[model samples]
Structures are given as structure tokens and as C-alpha cells.
Target chain A: MSDTAQAARAVIGDSEFDRDTAVTLREPGVYGIDLSAGWTIINAVNGGYLLSVLGRALADALPHSDPFTISAHYLTASQPGPAVVRTDVVRTGRTLSTGQASLFQYDDEGREVERIRVLASYGDLDSLPDDVRTSVKPPSFPPMEQCFGPEDGPAPVSGSSAIAERLMLKLDPATLGWALGSPSGKGEMRAWFGLADGRDADPLSLLLAVDALPPTAFEIGLSGWVPTVELTVHVRSRPAPGPLRVSITTRNLAGGFLEEDAEVWDSADRLVAQSRQLARVRVG
Target chain B: MSDTAQAARAVIGDSEFDRDTAVTLREPGVYGIDLSAGWTIINAVNGGYLLSVLGRALADALPHSDPFTISAHYLTASQPGPAVVRTDVVRTGRTLSTGQASLFQYDDEGREVERIRVLASYGDLDSLPDDVRTSVKPPSFPPMEQCFGPEDGPAPVSGSSAIAERLMLKLDPATLGWALGSPSGKGEMRAWFGLADGRDADPLSLLLAVDALPPTAFEIGLSGWVPTVELTVHVRSRPAPGPLRVSITTRNLAGGFLEEDAEVWDSADRLVAQSRQLARVRVG
Candidate 1:
């Protein structure tokens, strides 16, 4: 095997392949391979991998102590395909640092492909008014244990077709978990999220995993599934090093495009990163 | 009149006022006016205007020459809406100089309205390749003399529709003319535009005027129109100071969204700027 492949295998020992990490790989950066033809690819590179590789790079570049949050994430892909990725360091000041990146990918020939850009920053946390509060609170949902555990709910639909299916995923309507996250994770993520798959896991893992969910949700309301042209993510806050709950509230779908704006909250209800995506929907 | 209004009128001048220009002034930024209600508000600023402001700012900040071309432009906007603009300075060395800009917008209140970042520098132009060519060639349409005047086009379906009806109004095919501006005014632009009230003009005037053409060209087709959430433009090469020609082209439109990519080429067929936009399609 190639050195890269060997190293990847070494990192992914037998014990490391848990159900949660089964879909994800650690090398070439932490990536999720959609084994099936859905070809949904997710990666955890530069520390946190949501969508924006640039954002992830910036987050990776920041000092652990600096407070940085991903305020927003977006991406669009067209033409030659794949997608090209580029990053820019807007300003790397002592207290506040800003950076941006764009991904461009072409088809076999060097023709234009998809283009994605991400903006991110690291700095001191802003002080909120004493009386300030979020207008929308995270949803109260049952833990993945009670909702989708192997013994609790139906097995997740598997195979390539599973990528195109909607898991009827929804936040538990009864108990809204408190949002909580690490000091650095600050943007709009503190909320609640329920996967179509019934796995309960770490907030960081959930954060990385949920990034793949938007495109799937976008396909739910469409006549047929729409593939993602590109996915860009920005990490605003790091979840408290544990379980994180977030609610997917607003979904704006127009034209042949779909954008899902989710409020990701920590277990303590603190907002983390705000996530959104430009999904291309395909109708039969 | 508001200070903004007074300033706009003074800068624009009165020449049988173009309603579209007036709309732009009233709604100065990217966002358009809400014609449904009597309130005329500039919802969002255009990406091009933002780039101009930021580009000028960056150029003035850096020790550079008077004129320069943009190397790249990146932008992102959301539904319900907010947007951010970013630009980058490719190189500021002695020879040819380049820069880029991107804009980002959001829909949430507490979230950012829009972010605009620019990259630019000054340099000598001698080092650049003498035979650079553009893939998109300018269209050889007739001049304004042979085409219908702006007044000959269609009028606003409703005087109160915030929707830009002028873009939808078709002109006599012969009305095709070069957009007047820089000596190489090469790019894509079409107009008989304005309340459909036939008026004929050159390219620069069109640039200042067509800013009102929302990004609906991809969906309804050029013959039809739709509202644009955001507009992005990259000025690669400025035409010689005069009228230029723009060949309109639609790249792709899917789901309920559309993207129109236009190449503005000079009379000599040299490319000047690349323009593209994402528009939200209104559905029944």
C-alpha cells in the first residue's frame, strides 16, 4: 500500500472503527466516505471539519485560547465538477485574526469546476447585554439512545439508496437539552440536532457528522434527491468537549436551490456555529 | 429629502431620469426597494458597489498606481438574507497587479448584514503577457442607432411592483449596441431597459443603469425576469473609455435558483469583467 494508505490504516486500528466512526476516516484528514454512490464526502481537517476547509484551516491555525466562532457557512458548485479550494488570510492581527478560502475543482481536464469560499476569524469574545437572550431556543429532543439506538428505533436505511432517503429526522419534542460548548466554539452552534441515524455521541463528533445532514434534508422536500455541488462550513465555537444538542429550525428553499439555516446549541443551550448550505435540488 | 437622496440626485444628474437608476439610489445598497409598500428602502448594497468602495479604499491604502484590474471576486448571500464580500490582492509587485473581493450576507438580525473584503496593489503594467486572450468573445450586435430606444421597451407591469419590469422588456433585436465606457468596453449587457420607455445609450451609462437588473435572467430567461438577491461583478479589464459590447449568456439554472454568468468584452473582443448572480425564483 502507499505510505499515505498505510499510515491511514495504522491510525484506524480495529478498535477505532466504532459504528460512529465507521462512516468516517482519519487520514487525508478526518473524512466520511459515503461508501454508497451518494458520494457524500465529509472531512475533519485543520482540527474541525464541518464544511469550509478554509474555515477549518483557520480554526486549526488559531491559538487554542483565542475565541473564534464561525458566524456563517455557504458553498456553491457548478461546471467542470469536483471543486477547487483556496484560502486567504484576511488579516492575522494579535487579538483578532481573519481568513478566507475558496475551493475550485474541475473535471478531468483543467476546465472550471465548483468554487467554494469560506470566511473565518479568531478574537476575544464580545460581551453580551446582561438581559440578552436568544429569540429562538433549542428544541427538546430525546437523546439518540431512546430515539434511534439499535434496540430503540428501526435500523438506519443502508446502501447507496440510503443516501437518497430521508430518515424523518426531527428533534425530540419533549425535552430540550441545554446547550454547551468549549470556550472557543462561539458563533451559532449551541442548539439541538437529531440524526436520522440513532447514534448518540460526542458533541465534536456530532458537529462533524451533522455537516453531512443538510444536503440530505434538502433532498427530503424535493421530488428526487439532489447532490451537493460543494459544502462550506464555518466553526464559530467549539462545543464543550462532550455531547452537543442543536435544532434545525429555518429552511429556505427557493428556485432549484435550498439553504438550511440551523442553530447549533450546546448541552447548556449556548449557541455554537451557525450553519447553512446552497443545495442543488434535482427533480424528476 | 434624505441626505442620501439629495446626494444621489446630484451625482446622477437629471436626463429624463432612468427609473431603474432612481430605484438604485432609493435603495442604494444591494437590497432593492419594496415597491409593494410606499417605503423606499435600500435593502442590501450591490456587490459591485461594495467592491468599488472597498477596492478604492484598499488602493488608496496601499502605495500603488492610479488604475488596476481585479484578479478575482468572491461573494455569498443567504435567503431570508445577509451577505459577505471578500477580495484578495494576488500580487503587488512591479509588474501587472491584481486583487479580488467577496461579499457575504445573512438573514438573522443579530447576524452580520454583509462582509466585504478586498485585495489590491499597485504595479508596472509592462511585465504582463502581450497576447493574453479571453475565452468569451463579444457579440457583434448592431449599434443603438439601429435598435429601439429605451422608451420603446415595456413599462412596469405595476407602477408599485418593486420587481424590475424593465429587465423583462425586450428591445428591437436591431437595438443591440456596444456598452459605452472604457476604450475596451467588452462585457455582457443588454438594455432598452427602463420602464420599457425606450431610451438608447452607451455601455458605461448601461453599467450605471443595468445595476437594477435583478439576477432573474437565468430563471425566466433574458426575455423574462426575476428578482435577484445579490449581484457580483469582477472588472478584469476596463474597455477604452467608450461604448462596449456585452454578449448575454446564461450558464445554469436548476432547482428553483438560477445563475447567470456574463462576460463583458470590449469592441476588440477583449474581456473586461465577469458578472454572475444567484436569484431566488418566486413560485405560485
Candidate 2:
């Protein structure tokens, strides 16, 4: 319906995930990209997808390659367009390098908008100690046929959103309060996530998968635009193939403030990424 | 030993927790306080105390008073001094007000040292729906007398650290890897934490309690000072009076990086606060 949305779809269809998330070098610490709006929820883009874009830039500058950890502070809501990413290497050690990446965009008046500042660590996951292996058990799911997704038919409630077209989110209808028209009255959402284009979710793609689900706050009877204030994602293991099963829970919803904890498990049933965020419960 | 440390102890000793955690409002969005070093872990003060200090400042500027969620990024190590806290209102909505606070101190060069930035939410905990109650089971503990703390006698191996002199941390002993001279190899630590001065632990105090345990990495036989890269804390309920039970687990220790998740339960056995961190395995 909009020119930007049309452009986003074109860019996404024309490029692969590596290219869709690509950042071109602009000197040493500066990088730039024309962000596609294909992953937006209404007007705001998904937080994890934004972080993946920034993480890609930060990871490239580090000696080691894998993004071990990423903490993103959403300074302001941003839209699709040309954005600049600047990286500042804070601490470099033998095993990890900590860096801060700030994404900026210019307003119509040409004033710069500081959208996000991501604090991240890049290291070699392959080098981790395989001897000391332990994990929080991955959550179980019902039969795949019982789940709802683009494959099931078409997006019903979120059909108009760009992300619905870009991501294949098979939500467990038991927790889909919006679809059932009866809130679960609990703060939880479970879904199986993968790219609509069938691209394997690497650590970077796993970042986007964390935020791909509809806000779990809906299950608690809080209907609104749940904007993230700060999000911290921890990459646990190299994800296995197939759809990553995810569980997002909001344990405390007090005074319109809630925290969402999302655990992403790969098809092999191993935990891949763990994310927790602090957000205000916006009741629209 | 230092004047700032002495000042911190006096302030902490003289007031009740409510007053101790209260920040003096100098102006709108500006807060000032004489920070205490009584909660230091070796040379670097405990991350939770710093977070509590910053949380106090941000909560003061907000319309709602309780800090339901806090995610802090420690940019650099700080010391006891007159810390200046500045809060920036990021998002103000019907039920939540998300604000960012930066705590700054002047270094010996008279230059400003931005030690930490805290993203926090202030809201009414009483407004939470009581009917939808659930929690992960709290860990069990042996008799209080069987645990280890300063009052129990000597510190054993950790006694050399100044933090041992400052707080009372009673470990379960079953996972006290360093003290037992045998690593559990399970990557876990369980303990009971309370203020040393006999003060009841409040929400702010609960922040400190989360990081007060011995590094769980030590249980897996990883030695050294593990510095937290980023920490996200979720306060579920106003803690009940008495010592809080805690369980710390390190699921994956890889490539010189590890994650520690800490869950806290109040005396009444309610989940009070939960925290997880990404840290560099700094083996000194």
C-alpha cells in the first residue's frame, strides 16, 4: 500500500539474508546500510532484526567472528531508510572483544536520530570448552500440524504486517490470545520461527528469531504496542537446522512495566539464544 | 581504608534502607549521592549496589516509584566518591515510563568518568494482576547453621577478598568449589545472601544480592576474576523480610565467554528478582 513497504519487499526478494543484513565498510569504524522495512510490526521494525544488522557490523571489526553476546538499548523508534552504524571497540581480550555500535539516521530536517546503541562481544564459539556442557532443558511442543503459521493458511490477525510476510512464525494457538479472542491471562507465548525464504538461521538470524513472535504481553490481557526499551541477547550454542522453537515469558507485569524472557531452541532441541527485555506495557 | 569507603559505611550504617537508597533530587532529572564502597567485591564495588544507586536516581525522576526492571551496562570500574546521576526520559506511556540514567564520577585528572548507564522502569507493583501467579520452584537449602559465612567463622579461601569483610554470604558448601579444593565441574553455585549490617534486603538490596554469590564459573574449575560485560535484572516482587535464597548456574562456558543466570527467592519463598549476565572469563 505504501512506497516504502513495496521497496522493502523488493530489496528482500532480490537479496539473500547475508545481503539483506549486509553492511558496507565506510572507513574503519563506520559502516552504512539502507535498511529494508520488510520486518516491521506495524510501523516499528523488530528489535532483534535491527540488532542483527548492527551485530553484523560489530562482528566484522573484531578479531574473532561469532557474536557471543549483544545488549541493545533502543534509544528511539526508527523507520526504514539509510542508516549509519558506528562501532567503538571498548575492550579487547584474548577470548573476547567488547564493542559498542550506535545506529543513526537523519530526519527530514537533516538532524541525526540516534536509534540504538548495541553493546556486544564477538568471539569464536568453536573455541568454547566442550568438556563443561550443561543447559536449561528445551521446552517441548505439540504436533506441528496444530500450530498456526503462513503455511497453515495466511496470517489472520497480523496478516498486514510486513514481518508476517518475511517470517514464518508458527505460533501455538493456545497462547495466541489475539486469535482466540480470549486472553490466556498469563504472560507467555510459544512459537516455532524460521525465515519465510527458508534461509538457515545462523547466530545472526537467531537474533531476529528472538523478536519475531508477537508480543507475549497480549497473553496477560495487555493489548498494545509493546515497544522495547532495552534488550539483552545471549547466544548459547551454534544453532542446529530446521525451525527454532521459542518460548517467551513475562514473569512480572507490574505497574505497566514487564520483562519478557525468550529462549530459542534449534531443531536439534538445543538452546541457541536466550533474550530478556525491559519494556513498558503500552495499552493501545 | 579510604575516606570515601569510610563515608559510604557511615551513610549505610546510619540510615534505614529506604533512606539509604533514596537519592537527593538536585533538580529535575538530576540526582546526587555520596556512594558507598561498603559493598565492594575486591576493588571493584558490587555491580548490584551500583545498579541500585542508579535505579534510585531514575525512579526518583519518574512518576511511578517502584523500579520493576533494571538493565545496567558497566562501562568501566568505579570507586567510592560523589557520584552524579542523570536520567533521560526515553518513553513515557500510560502504565510505564522507561528512562535511562548515567552515573558519573570525576577521576584523579578531574575528568568525568562515566562508570555506568542504567535502563530502568518505574511503576506500581501493586497494580499487577494477582490471579495469574506462577514461578519456577525455588531451590532447597540445608539448615542455616550448616552454611558458610563470615559470622560462621573464617572465610576459608575467599576470605582474602575485602568483599568477604563487607557482606555476609552463606554458601551451600556443596558447590563451594574453591573451598573444597575440588571443582564440582557442574557449573553451578547456590547461596544465601543478606546485608552484613543486619538490614532487611529491599528491592535495591536485592540487586546486590543477585551478584553477591561466588562466581559460578569457579564451580566448573574456571579460575579468576570474571568481569560482567552486561547484566539484565528483573524484579518480580517486593522481597519478603529475611535472607534471600539464590541459585546461580553457568550453562555453557565457551571460547573464554560464559553466562551466569541468578534467580532470587524471598524469605516467603516468592521469586523476587532474576538476573543473567554475559561476562568474560577473566582468569587472573
Candidate 3:
């Protein structure tokens, strides 16, 4: 096995099955799985598990696929808990390969959990239609060299939560000296994300990694406390190789709820992915 | 008027702009903005524009006081459009007198074109805790009687586009309904909904209405198309009111380049609204 693959397996397996797993195949590049524990607690399977399994199967079905960069967007857990995943390739087209997978979690009695349908495609990146336009821009802030890491200073009040600490440790204010790429080659970035534990993870891990950041980011900006009810992300493209930097902005928040949308850009200003999340606020 | 009140008027008009002006005062209630245009062409002014304005203002404020409801849900301009609405108390919470309003459209020059918001609260209804649940049941098929306005031998598709005709005319074999009040005396609901026009509209619109289908009567089944990019709903109780039903599902074409989410729902088993949408699909 390659060193990269070995390292990935180590981190994922070491972490209580919390990270997404990717497997490379000759036909469609690489496949991945987003696993979870089901609500039954006894069965050890759930909704997210099924979706992750499905994701992996889809990835394996494509031809002319890029093994270097493959991923699945948001796969949700309809019913909470640990779940198992399985994948299968649907078809391989000239330009694109299609794949599907199923997520299964058990009920209290060890019955099958709800199933989720997984769909994925692989191939040369396609250009957006002439009419579709992105209004998001890369965020400008202090560079990594000048910024303080979470451990470098006292953690922010919001950083008290484990999720918050994980986020702060993964993100940098600026994107200097990072590899970048995007379909448009103009407005997104990706970098080698430095985790507190000193391990590098994939885009799916990065997503789980950053999910808790917006609330912290926003809370610090507002100088208050904000709790997120749920967070959802849409991956447009993967970040280029290197330390990752994410550019985000607040779209809108109403009815005690806040929505923040982000355009994840590679260091080269390419649109790697787009994410949006909803959060509930707790006033001081 | 207070400084905040006066400043608000400068940007929006006075509270008494029009009976259907779209913006109304309601302590604790969210502000409403309606964006609807006459048939031929529905511009952003009626929807996106209004949301942009209301979203911005709401962001500046914190924790409102009045209780509000989303009475209507549909599609416009092939996109998801939701009106932030507010309700004002007529009897000051004594006898349950209240008024509601919303701003629909904003012209190219940023003026409202079509808008609607309603005000209501259980008048003389018993004061209760957050103990309602949805008892409403979904139908096994479309409620043709309530949806077609009586002269129904199967509703005719009415729209300028052929695509719309196929969608509006094709009836799905599914049931739709909604239950109001609480099942376990908790304010919740179970609802079913689908397209009034029968054709698909936009994913975002379908999601918005599905998310806004009030609380279910029991453990309301939350299902829809589009894989739910993100979903967030809040309820004070369970068993909301009537058995509101919504039906939504979709199909993708062109190697999944584009897809749609279709939906329909009944108010008291009566057709209330319908929606459809387009989306970008990725295969994994």
C-alpha cells in the first residue's frame, strides 16, 4: 500500500470510526464511505452508515475517473446512530461514471435502519453554463504566519466546546503559500489543513472539521454565544493539494436562526466547494 | 416614533403603507416580505429581492417577541421564494386578535409588486403549553376534490409552457394530508403536500415550503425530494392542527446535470399550495 493510503487508514481507524474512508479502484478512481453509529446503540448501524456505503459503491463504478480527487457531498443521517455502508457502480459513461450506495442503521430490535440513496459522478470537471454565475469572493484576512493558532493563545469563550476547539485548530485567517484550484480558476482555495492532533484528513473530514467553525466565527464577531441546530455543506470541488483555507460569509439569519454560506476555494482561487449552515443563537 | 422605529420606516415605508403592503408590526414576530409578480414574468424583485431586504434587516435585530406562522408555501421564478412574515395583535393577546402581512415583490427599481401575509392565533382557544403533536394523516393519493376547485374530472394543466402542462396534468399515485393541533398535546403535525400546478418548479422553493409546513400533528413524517441539502425546523409543541399533507418527488435528466423537486399539500385536506424546482446533481 502507498504511504498516503496507509496514513489515511491509520487516522480513520484510530478515531473510533469517525472519519470517511476512501478506496481506490481501477475503473472509477477512488470510492469513499461516511460511517456512523445507529440509534439502537445495540445494532451499531444507522442512516449515515448506509449513505456512506452507497457513496463508496458509486465511486468504484466510474471509468476515466480521477483517483486523486473523488468525494461525496452531504450524506445525512435520517435516524440517528451507528450504521453500515455499501456501494456499487451504476454505470460508466464516456465522460462521466455514475455510482450508487445505500446506508443502513438498525432499529432498537436490530432491524434495518432507514435507507438513503447515494449518487455520485466522476470525470473531467465540467464548466458552468453561460448563465450561471457565482457572486462569492475569496475572503481576505491575516496570513497563517501572522495568525495565532488555538494553542498559541487563550481559546475564545466559544472555543470551550470540543467542536469549537476542533474548528479553530483547523482554520487559518489567511491563505498564503497554499496550493489552490477551482473550475473557474479564480475564486476558491484548498490547503493542507493542520489539525490539533497533527494529522491531515480528506475533504469529508475537512467538512466535519469545519462544520463547527461558522458558529464560533460568527459568535466571536458578534461577541456572543451561538449554538448551531444543524449544519449542511455542499461540495462543488475538492481543495487543491496542501494546507486548506476556507472563505466564508454570512448570507442571512432570521427568527433566532442564522444562515452562513461559504465558498471553499483552493489557494489558487478556484471554487472547490460551497457550504451553508443554520444555527440557533443563545443570548448572553 | 422611537429612533429605531423611525429608522426602520426610512428604509421600509410606515407600518400603514397598505393593507397588503407586506410589512407589518408584530412584537416578537418575524417581519414578512412577499415577492410575487403577475404571470408572464416573475423577476427577482418579487422574491429574491424581498428576501434580501428582509434578511438583512432581521440580521441586525435579535430575539423578536411575537409568535408567527407561515400560512402559504409555493414557487416563483423557478426558484425557492419564502416571505418572512409578521403578525400584530389586535386585542393584545387577550382575545387573540391579530393581523399578518408580508412583502412579495420588489421591482427592478426595488419596489414591492405582489405581497401577502396573514395574521392569526387560536381566538378563544385554550392557552396551552408546548404539548401539541400532529395527529393529521397523509392521503394515499392526491386530494383531487380539494385541489381542482370542484369541476374536477382530473384537473387540466394550465400554464404557458408544455413542460408545465405535463407536470401539472400528471397525477401521482400518493396520498397527501396534514394534521393540526397536537397528537400528544404537544404542538406538532404530520403533513402531506405536492404541486398545485402539478409541474415541478425549483428545489429550493420545494424545500422552503416543506420546511415551513408548520409543525406536524403527530410525529409528522418529514420526507421530500432533492435529498434535503439542509433542513431546520422548530416547534413549541406537537400535534399542531389539521392533517396537512404534502407530496414531493423528482427525477433528473441529462446525466444529472439538472433535476427537479416537485411538491403539493392540502389545507384541511383541501389543496393549499404546490411547488417544483431545478437542481444540479452530482453522481458519486
User: In model 2, what are the clashing residue pairs, if there are any?
Assistant: A128-B254, A128-B255
TM-score of each model's B chain?
A: 0.49, 0.89, 0.27
Shift of residue A5 alpha carbon in model 1, Å: 20
Which number leads on DockQ? 2
Name the docking class for model 1.
incorrect
Q: Please report, as a residue range, the 10-residue window in candidate 2 chain B with the lowest summed lDDT.
A: B1-10
Best by lDDT: 2
Q: By summed lDDT, which 10 consecutive residues of candidate 1 chain B come out lowest?
A: B178-187
For candidate 2, what TM-score does chain B get against the true chain B? 0.89
Expressed as tens digits, the lDDT of each residue in B1-284 for candidate 1 is: 22233332222233222222222211212323211211111343343333434444344333453233222222332222223333344334343244444444545466544354433333332333344422223556665555543334453222233223222233224223321112122113353232222233322233323344333332232333344433334344434433445444332233333434444555455555444443434443
Worst 10 residues of 3 chain B by lDDT: B228-237
Measured against the true structure, the TM-scores of the candidates, in listed sequence, are 0.39, 0.78, 0.38
Clash count, predicted structure 3: 162
Query: How much lDDT does candidate 2 score?
Result: 0.75
Model 2 residue A117 CA deviation (Å) reads 3.3
Candidate 2 per-residue lDDT over residues A176-254, each given as its tens digit: 7666678788788899787766666788887888788878877777678888867888887788767789899987665
Could you tell which candidate, 1 or 2, scores higher by DockQ? 2
